[model samples]
Target: MSPPDTDLLHSLSAELSERLKDLLDQALLGMIRPNSASQFAQHAPELENFREAITHSDAKDDMDFLRNFREFVPTTNYEPYRPYIAKFFATPCKESDVKNMFAPGLPYCLAVSSMTSGKSAKTFPTYRPAPHLLHHPLYLSFPHSEGSTLSPSSLGLWQVLTVECEDGQSSKVLPVCAVTVGFQRMQMNWEVEHDKDRIDLWVPGKTDPFAISLVKSYRAFFILNALFALSDRRVATIRFLFASVFVNFLQYVEEEWPLLVDCIEKGIIPDMENVDHVRESLEKHFTANPLRAAELREIGPPGIQGWAVRVWPDLKMFIGITGGSSAASVPKVTHVLGPSVTMQAPCYGSSECFIGLPYYNGDPNTDFKVLPVDGVIEFLDVHSDEPFERVLSAWELVGGGHYEPVLTTRSGLWRYRIGDVVTVKGFAPDDGLPVINYLHRRNGGLEMAFGVTACTESQLTNAIVSASKRSIGQIIDFTIVGDERDTPITYGYLVEIGGEVGEDAKMAIEQTFEDLMANNEFRVAFWQGRARKPTIRLVKKGTFTEYRRQKCDKTNISMGQVKVPIILSDSTSKEWFLQRVIMEL
Candidate 1:
């Protein structure tokens, strides 16, 4: 059943919370193990036929779907086939094409893949029979539906809609337009005509929207734009809004604390972005209730511990993506939002396909049940030497096993290796499907001693966060690069912080990083004098931002999608970062 239309003013009502919770519970009721198995079997014929048809040019009669897929399908990489994929589908309109180049004839809309893979964005499409090909007799009974009900991959929209907002409005509003802040985009509109269910702060966009170009300068301008465009009611709700990405949220708060306080302490909208109507509306709202400003100040500053709920008493949850590498930033976000806001990853997916649904009773890591209806999934054991040949199906996965997923989708991507490694937590009691948690990217980590012991991006990020919190004040950004010049071959850490860190503090941080990695087998190699100790070098504060700007200019990709390469692989990029080192931390 659809949730009752809630007033933004009455978001904190107990009635509303219970209703939303009940809706979520009903959605999870039908996901039984037998049902999941039946769903997989139902899609098997379509999956097998698609695989066969795509590889027909290089047909192998007795080819095994698991083992021989690599031999028949062209390159698994999506770059070269872009032109063909676009041409294969029909256009929405002859004169005006889709912005992301999704063909109108496809069953579902194209979702933009996250550029977090350190590669350009690719269009993620799912199963559908080609319109022209449907004229054949065999295709007569095929369904002419728009698409499946399930959103392709980790859409994260469900969390936004159900999670209680301070103003009682669903996070989404139809009239909300994309507000560009430097290279980043915010889900807000400054126009006079806007939906009544307006968002107070940032909301998740089509992309994560945490671009590399959103530095201090851009943040300052973004704050001013927000202040000028919003009135007392919207400004009052600032303390309750959830940002799409944790780092982006933290940066925004750090840069705009003073402005936030001013809006609360006094119900005044500064005339900055020429939105006079907003200022007048706020003045009228404040005039009606002169004591509202004082009442808001009584709750105290949001930057302080436990102030999130105190500032906005009705706020139910802080929903956003805080898993994977961004896990380190959770504590900081919680410190501001307080423990009342329930933060969660909600689902697991990628640019390629929406893979899993959130298991409600799962662990805090947000384990998900693989949705067989999305596509045919194959699990490759991470520890296996010959992973391809030993690929496991959905039912073949065992609890505690780490496997990289290979998906065969209707969009014509057969046996496409997703590169992400997910750990099989266990099967859900209700649904017999494997419950999995995303671990890290296969090759995306700090390499040690010719791949003897590589640390995942999250591990590296955790070490940096822990060490920085103990010694250095806070880090702006960081990256790990291989130091091939050293005889023993050590790793070099490039860190950017607000101010200088003393030698003693730097030494303490480096030691702490080593101590944190004591559990890893790399410690034995280090003690045996094989792998040298990693060094930490402090770069200028804006070095990473400058690198991103240069990269965007060179690659000609949108600056908004550019992400900092956590592990510097190329010699040219490594040299560029090394050249800007200010001190050896």
Candidate 2:
């Protein structure tokens, strides 16, 4: 029943050829996308300047064929992270130390320690506002086990509906990450009513091809990382060699010809399985009541499928998705203008820096501009022994830039270090302002966030210390993990036991957190909009180390490289309760 070895080789060759052909086509399209660009200029005012950039290349770069097929960049605001340098509080700011800092009309930032959600979120508006109730869970969706599988929510800022179905009904809708599709299956959810000239937002599951195929290619990158890191020495070496060769081939595809990535490209093949994690995850969450999605009794008063949300009344199942970096159906924001948008992927910040965000002219379909506030960014030599933070002694309410932002807002911030690396992309032509890009997160600043300004581990530690009366010795250590992203309840963290605290003591600690956070001013300012209580788990000794090891192994990262690990997982983070380590994994 097995295919012959010759046939398998032939099949792979054909697949490779097909992939190559598609890449070539996309590349051609990207280069000559003049017609599309020409048409867009009339509608979007922001593109007025870029029109020259669009037509700058008379001939294809040929080199950028694959990396940037069709010369099209889906308007995004991802750039390098900003490094933190909160220098105002060289010493921890006590309540009194900051009491006189506030004046009328001055922004009173309530920075809290990130130990417990109540303290961190309740202490800041960004962490616990109404929007946060929708976005916080997203911080919990991507598991280290799952490679780059994110809900489409993070793409909410740039959602564009570009498809139409047979039925003659259509309206702009946000992406799945922003709101639920009400359909049990993502496939059905993508079925949109038709519109005459409007772009459709109802993207079918991966089956429809186009962007899905491009997403599928990402799996290869993930596999490459895994193969490169395999425990087997010889095998890993061989895989690396093969990967190097493939990289050359891929480079050829990117540089010479670029159109093949799209499923819609001529001769492009289907590879739906590679990019269906978002839909599949949704299914796993709702398979118990599969029929719940079939509430479209056409004659009935707008059934469940008619709304963005649906309920399986009998099973008491409520289905929704947390938005992140997935490619899925969403609405078009052609009319919103650009100021409201922020890029998702390359948010600017690092360990010593904490206040950088993405730049979208506020437009969802364009490149981002990085703008760091005076106190948001800082710089350090690559060989520095410790972070030498740079900051302004006072606040600059009016934005000014060029230097890496070194922030010390009301959040009780001192000379805190953010770790984002950056390069000056350019000065904004429109405003003559500086723009930045978010590189990867620096090695030492990563940590769990319940949407609380992406709170840091040390901040959380301080909060826990402030909340608990027990000595630090009683609590050896704790790890904060982001839980489910699209639920009534948001995040949960597990604590590894060190001291003699038992259930009674732990209960007392939880009460302490609730009492202090509920009453704290910073907590009130930050986490006022959230509703769920953060779940805390007390674990056995050494459990924390084991977790760190597994996490390190999973991420292919060395221990001590990153100070804290943020669990951006939607599934396991939400479901798995604490497992007592009778034995370590």
Candidate 1 clashing pairs?
Answer: 8-167, 33-431, 33-432, 153-354
Report how far residue 101 has shifted in candidate 1, in Å: 11
Kindly report which residue stretches of model 2 are placed more than 4 angstroms away from their true locations once superposed.
1-461, 468-473, 481-491, 502-504, 507-512, 515-534, 562-570, 573-577, 581-585
Cα lDDT of model 1 by residue, 134-247, tens digit: 232221211122211100111111000111223444322211111111001111222222322232222231111111112123333334333332222321222111122334
Best TM-score among the predictions, by candidate number: 1
Error of 2 at 367 (Å): 32
Q: Scored by Cα lDDT, where does model 2 land?
A: 0.28
lDDT of every model, 2 decimals: 0.47, 0.28
- How much RMSD separates candidate 1 from the native structure? 13.6
lDDT for 534 (candidate 2): 50
Query: Lowest summed-lDDT stretch of 10 residues in model 1?
Result: 150-159
Tell me model 1's lDDT, rounded to 2 decimals.
0.47
